[model samples]
Target: MDDWVDPGETLETASFERLYRGALELASSVERTRAATLVLLTGRLGLTLEEALHCNEGWVDWERAELQVPEKDPCACAGCWELARRRREHTDPIREVLYEECWSPSPDRAPRTVPFGWSRRISAALLATADRYLLDLLPGDARELLRAAGEAADGIEPDDLTPGLLAATTVDFLSDLGLEADGTAAVLGVGEARVEPYAAAGESDVTTRMARLAGVDGSADPESAFPVACGTEAFESEPFDVGAADADALAERATATDAPERVPRPTDLPASVDYDPADHAAAGGPNRRTDAGSWAEGPSAADGNENALRADGASAVTGADRGRAGLPDDPSTASGSQATAPDVTCARDVVTQPVVADFSTRAAADGLCGGREIPGRVILGQEELFVLWSEEKGAEDADAPHLLVPLEDVWDVRIDDVPGRLSASFPHAVTVGHRPSGRDELAVSIQLPPAQRRDMASALYRILLNVTPMTVVDPAREGGRVTDADPEEMVLYVRPHGVAFTDEAGDAARLAFDLSDVVDVERIERSFDGESRPAVQLRRVTDNRPVTTVVTAADDRLRRLVWRYVRREYHQTLATVRGIRLSDAEKMVMVALYSTDGTPDLGSLLDLTEQELSAALQSLAAKELVRSAEAATDLTGTGQLAVSDRLESVNH
Candidate 1:
């Protein structure tokens, strides 16, 4: 065979149009059926050589204006058998790991139905040439005819002529004429057709030929005609202007490369405000002495006659102590002054203040690390929850050691009201379950003040709602009437990762199911007390054992709700390909696979080469629409949904 020109390579629009018109005109030299086959193969119908060859008269539906491509039995060729053997070998290890049966022994192919309209040109061609076996119309001289056609148009030999090349050329021509895939399909009386990736640009001589033939202006705007080629040049040619003063400033800044000796002060800093002693006292400063007498009035006051010196602002106070207390120097006690001195408060004096909780108490001591009984205050920050604790009691120190837990690490939370008998001061108990980095699951319990319990719970709940992907459904709010069979009231939460059944209050999680483990969901009826109640049954596979859960409700709508949401989640999780744009070949393969039953031999059925089919399958797998090509070749739940949505659009 001669070296075949790659159909995916770029072709000039003018050349493509010339070759296409030449092929149609040269159809007269061949048999009637052979000529019709060539036209059909090169048109917007997107047919493969094998499919066009296999087509028969029975495929057409005149009344419905439709065409049906009947399914073919599995090919027993040596190539197919070798391909199957390689697949089985590759999937054997995977089957062992999953411990489940994967592939079916034999699969059946499903026929595809496409919309077709009756037009004068197409009707006449089909009526004159269509037969029981269309391939019979083509003789061994077909290659000679293709060579003659190519030479007449672009001086190319028969080696360059192929079904893919012809189809790609025709699709590109139609696209340049302002007809999209759907529009082209309508005009040609075929299913969906799309322009190939490499044929997107209409810059070549082929485009000029096509323009002349179609009566379109060939000298239209270059940017619109060739966006990929002219985009950067157009952008670079745009004018930009700068003012003289701005340019001078920019140049000055660029030239000043020398390092300054000292950093310049920011001009935007605010001026200092005068200090007020009364305001400082109200803000918990050292000046206002309470019933607790100041050390200046103690017995040491006389020894510090010494006290007289301190009163006169002559006492030696260390700068470190003032800094530790976050205090400013007293203006009244300046040097050479006789004003009364304010009492000084040291770090030790500040440490003696009482805290909100008594850390030494037995109840508070039980919540720390393995009963080590350290004293601490639990502080909930915006992103993390932490406990600040110190060995010394009665101290609220910011420098104390603490344990930080990011809110995301917390997976479960339990809140309960502490009985009065346990501890009257600490009335609310909150336990948080978390798994920290490289650590096993652990629980931390804390007692909250009576007044702060509601606020703390509300904040934690808000954080959980924002971070966790969950949809809470209240049975009562959704008009569900609970039956006696399920006496315990429960709430249903549908989540992307899983589902959970909680108590009616939505606080306690009673049961949970991961989405992956769920195999099926259906509606069933359960009898209790001589009455049948509608119920939804969830079937899951866990630990190689089947487990079933049936939730009963008085009304059938409740069952429907559960079934609908579960199915919807399954479809959504598997069908991530939805709403995503696919390539032309990928879309066609997806539709073909969806229209089939079981794991049919798509390569043979669609008449696709092994490489072409493999490429399409790999692309679909990357988008998560199917398993890898080496695995069972079938459309996943997501793939099916994607094809269904496409068909729905076509129908509309």
Candidate 2:
């Protein structure tokens, strides 16, 4: 039985709780130095001061981090040290800890050793597994971490002693590789970390403050979040600057340069912004030039304003010698002559690019591993189709959209319907799962799109309108050929169509059913004797629709029975597949482990204490069946060897 506190135990009692409580109470009532006295007595001596103050004092260690005590020595320092000198003594050596160390399973057992080449291979394996499982679902950071773990596992030696360092290193590696974007990190199961790019161009002071505010000293739930702080700081330091030196001066200068308009003035300004075509041949001419049409909502050709900006500063200089062209070299206009300049311009039209249509096609079909098909129909559950079809190059002007067709309309099924895609299946079928009492419909494996999800109940209601009922058929007595000359010989014929038969009287018959309608047919035969050359004889019945045949031999019958048992229970022959069933093994292991406390090395299963057995079992994991229930706790205070011994016993 486990130990419980005694009723008579008090401050003077030798029980652990009593001494510990007395020390705590005594220390609290006295000064700090006096508290030290209580600590020394209870922690180092493991006894009350009254019980341990009289023991020897040579076991104390003032330099090293430990206290050495002889196996049989009853060392005590309470009486040896005077009260005044205790405070100045070196740090105490014997530290007493009360809590148990909770042991979690170690991923590996051997000491660390660097395996550079092997680590790479391991990383490649991990990457391949991740790729195969569709787990590239994490944010960039997490994805990077997974990738890093793979790399590190490949490159590192076995002797690395960093504690929880591997996990962190992987996180950092992912961030460095820019794999932390989107949602990669979380999907990859990598731990969190902070990543900052453009740090050089970024404001260091602001980032530091933000980082500090979110660090250890920061409030767990502050009034403001970290991102908010960064945003607020940016806003306060750099508000919009429309009046800055860059473009504001140009706008201001342009205002002063314009001449006042006259009531009876020409539709265009005498000297307005405009392009001159002659300037096109000149060096360093206008980088861009446009006519009235350039302005999206500008005057049209019918408007007089279209050609009125010939002298405007916006016009390009066609030639440096403008005076020879009868135009004022400076801003002054020529006397009564139109100041003309060649228009150097180009027209640019903005067009919209249509979105390219794309989609994938998946069918609701049988899974290759295990499932069933009903008559004239097949039931598929969470089945996935992965087709590799390349998208057609988009025509420059077409608006074509892609579509997905499920089941390809059942009536159109053909031998080559799913070329290169063959499926082998088991017999379980899908059905509506459990639901809340008031819930009237089942949810689909894939959630409905937003439009449909909004009214899932209604969508499901419409779906249930056309669901067909399943049909069942028996195969025995369907069709078989019987020989008239030999009453014991019966031949059964099975075809893609319903089973057919021929009686001993030379009569042929066929069942009126679809080939898909039949599931299984059993030929029941009775075996009597334990041994015989033929082993059994057929007992025939003429009036049993088609015919009936029974065999005789106990051994033959027993062998057949076992075959049927396997078909009914497992639904498949064990020797035919490669897989493991862990449920039965789990039950057996638990029984053995719990009953016998395992020993060190776990070599001996017959003799084990409860603690040893518990530890042994806790160190290992059950590997066979898929566990559907809660797991049992492990034993403590026992070493690995003891646990291993117990495990071997339980397993054996």
**Candidate whose TM-score is highest:** 1
Cα RMSD for predicted model 1 = 34.6
User: lDDT (0-100) at residue 624 of candidate 2?
Assistant: 18
Query: What clash count does candidate 2 reach?
Result: 58
Lowest lDDT block of 10, candidate 1: 284-293
Candidate 1 residue-wise lDDT at 575: 36
Q: Please provide, for model 2 over 1-652, each residue's C-alpha lDDT reduced to its tens digit, 9 standing for 90 to 100.
A: 1121222211111222222222233222222113223222222222222222221112221111011222222111222122212433354322110011111112221111111111111112212221122121112322232233223333332233122222233223223223332212231222222222201222212211222333322333221332211111211212122112111222232233222111111112124323221222222211111010111223211222221112111221111113322233534321221112211110001111110111211112333112111111111111111111112211211221111112111111111011111120110111122122334322112111112121222211112211111111122232354333222322122222222222222123322222222122244442223222222222111211223222211233222322232122122212111122223333343444444433233324335556654443443343211111233332221111122334554455
Tens digits of per-residue lDDT, candidate 1, 460-563, equal 43333221212222221111234233335454443334555554433456666665444456776655446666666655543323455566544433344455
Provide the overall lDDT of each model, using Cα atoms, as 2-decimal numbers: 0.40, 0.22
Q: Per-prediction RMSD in angstroms?
A: 34.6, 37.1
Candidate 2 global TM-score: 0.15
